[model samples]
Target: MPKKVVAETERRRRRPTRQGTVLSEKLIVQTALRMLREHGSAGLTARRLGAALGADPSTLYRYFAGLDGLTRAIGEELMGRALDSWTPTGTWRADLRSLGLAIHASYLAHPQAALLTASRVTGRPREIEVDETILGILRDAGFDDIDAVGTYHAFIDLALAFAALDAGALAINDDVREADEDMWTSTYAHLPPETHPHITATAHLLADRMNHSAYPAVLDTLLNSAEARLAGREG
Candidate 1:
């Protein structure tokens, strides 16, 4: 009986065992996006990701080349997710608004990934689609082909630059609001009244206008500038 039990145990140990399959590429991206939402850029490393996914660090390389590639994949995933809900309304203004806000919200929601990927020019598939949409919006908004391309060049560049800056600020633990508070309360508190009279006097008002309000206001400013330049060229 003891010999039979020992033989059975050996057979069980030798039998082909199935542990759960390692995570897939899409699964890794999804989990990484979640981790990015919870922790900032410093939290996202291959080792950390591997730990979170219950796999060895090297397992991730089968899916993503490295953290930079992972970051790019995250960016593309963000764009893909954002575009899933985004449909063009045929009106250029509406289309532009949707595209800009969608990209902003998507990146900001994963601020860590945003900080890593926002400034990068991925030229990924979804990014090309985004560029196409921007050009289409410009053309729809009464721009000729040349005007469309030029306006697209300006609009996308400005929007992406702003997105990167804003996301970078927002990613670092309320640094955006905290820094503004410091600037107003601490930095401006001791400045001499005579030489810096303007800032000292108007600092209170400046404080109120710099919140989420800046997004729409900056967008308006960019659109206005682009429109004015188009007018100049046409004139």
Candidate 2:
């Protein structure tokens, strides 16, 4: 089916459940996000979602085609939230940095949901808006068509890659995550400096930094490279 037709069908319904809970696309998407957070991805089944909304499982088809559609909706919601309070700052690098951080922060807020949807393209309204905004920033920053497209792809892919990696770490169960974290100190730190000279020497620094996200540093590097490319093209 065509995308507009699908969108129209999804939006054409808003009904009250037997228990009087009003059901709309926004409500369902928000509830689904909550479900993913509280119950994890595996727990967000049709039956559970229906029960949470006081509706029949089949009722969700009125708003979303299936689990995949709902997943995309949830992804769109994440994208929307990221851009909710953000506006372009006119400086391309600064604006891109802010937008990148916002998206990463939003995904990490719901790691389980992010695990399912962070890397997928929804092609929905907010997702399109984000892409357009990025392209606009690049074009306005004096990048020509080829450079703008290339840099836009790199910037978005880099941000999403780190978001997925960080969210995956956050999605691990608490006990296991703690044990994994402790390995930096308890395992690597204790390695003999003779056989494992480099790791042992930098073990303290590794442990201190391992717990933090590298998105910001990586983002700066990417922007710097893009800036250099722009300058080279001008020269």
Candidate 3:
């Protein structure tokens, strides 16, 4: 038998921990997500997770090789939720917009989980499926191979970047986030116009816009560029 297969077989053969909780991979991943929400990224240690699940920490290895393996599973879980909730509209531009928004919303929904997993290269199932779907969307819309890949790269990165950025804001305590938001009004809006003319001029706009996620506007800009490119090709 192959070493990898043999190792997996042995890991699965281990019985439940002393607590006798019948554990599964899904349960572990769910517990991890909850723990991340309640305690933040640093609090998601094996010991704490095991305690939450009422199993020994070592028992988790039966389902995942280690915490890193578990982290990748958590990332996959979030991606799966994003893909599952989205229904493509068949029009490529509109579909792409919907898909990007779905992903952004999913990560923001689980801010702490997004903070830990959004930037990871999971190369897992849901991630692969998302990549394939985006590539397919661009290719089917008449983009050549290079253009499709370029757009796919930018689209996925932009969504995940916003997810991470916005999730960071959400992951912070309400006090800090409120204070940061108020800074645009309290600090920038009141800036001395003589010394900071540009900011002073735009302070109201900044206060209105800066507190909101730029994901939707930026996503539209990206899609608009792609649309113009397609129009150019047709012309």
Residue pairs in clash, model 3: none
Q: What are the runs in model 1 whose C-alpha is more than 4 Å off?
A: 1-22, 174-179, 185-192, 211-213, 228-235
Model 2 pairs in collision: none
Tens digits of per-residue lDDT for model 2, 88-170? 77899899999999999989999999889978999889999999999999999899999999999998898888888999999
Per-residue lDDT, model 1, residue 139, is: 72
Ordered from best to worst lDDT, the candidate numbers read 3, 2, 1
Residue 111 alpha-carbon offset, candidate 2, angstroms: 0.3
Candidate 3's displacement at residue 38, Å, is: 0.8
Ranking by TM-score: 2, 3, 1
| lDDT of each residue in 58-175, candidate 3, tens digit only | 7777677678888999999998998999999889999999999999998999999998998898988898998899999999999989989999999999999999999999999999
lDDT for model 3, please. 0.88
lDDT of each: 0.71, 0.88, 0.88
Where does model 3 exceed 4 Å of error?
A: 1-21
Clashes of each: 0, 0, 0
